[model samples]
Target: MLFGKKKDKVHFNPGNRDDGSHEQEIDKDYVEEEVNKIEEDDVEVVLNNEENIDKKFSGNNTLSKYVELGRIMISMLKDVKNGNYKNIPWFTIATIVMALLYVLNPMDIVPDFIPGLGYIDDVAVLTMGVGWIESDLHRYLDWRMENDMGI
Candidate 1:
């Protein structure tokens, strides 16, 4: 119900508008509701589409900044799947999956086909997701180092 019965797609637009009028504010509650719906299979889809996701990130300079962080997030999910790491909370995992899913979708808020401006929202989502999960991510990093898991 997040996209009015459009189960396959979700989009978000944030910040001020060009005409000096607020178009729409991101519905945080709705977003949280949808993100919480994400499951392990959803995360697996993102992992399975890693090639396409990497292409999307590498195709845009702005999105490229998030590539490393995205990799780390994906790695953490893989670790959780393999039972190699379980310190992360499900909410954190869900958040990461949501962000990755957002990135994988080309027809997002701004539509990736548009040059220059398309990736702005993606960067925002990735940045927000990272901010939300920073502590858990750091813990995962520490655990990664201790386990000699190179990333």
Candidate 2:
């Protein structure tokens, strides 16, 4: 077996330092662009997975799951309109964004194109939002505590 050479850990010092060196900075925008590029490829791979194209969840199929989730999100919005999740507007908004991101993630568990892992990632993100929703239930319940129909 060939042994690989180990790299030394980076050391940084602000003053009294020899061999003055600075970390190369990567542009945040460039990094984000690269990440988006990779995700797009992942989406293509997921879309091409034949085995993952027909999986079923609940009373609907995988594609249906995404649509159903969208409907549920609308219902959640109605709940918000009625004032269910209060005092946690940021949390609700973040949760909504995460949910949307998950829905938009084409490469998921079993690789939807692969037959099993295709929808896994989306499901995982959804599960996380659900858990957060549950933990933040009190905030929502508080919102439901009163109706200021004076508007």
Best by TM-score: 1
TM-score for each prediction? 0.78, 0.39
**What CA root-mean-square deviation does each model show from the true structure?**
7.6, 17.4
Which segments of model 2 are wrong by more than 4 Å? Answer: 1-70, 78-88, 108-111, 135-151
Residue-pair clashes per candidate, as listed? 0, 15
Candidate 1 segments exceeding 4 Å error: 1-27
TM-score of 1: 0.78
Worst 10 residues of 1 by lDDT: 1-10
What clash pairs does model 1 have? Answer: none
lDDT of each: 0.73, 0.41
The candidate 2 region of ten consecutive residues with least summed lDDT is: 1-10
lDDT of 2 by residue, 83-111 (tens): 55334443344454445544454563335
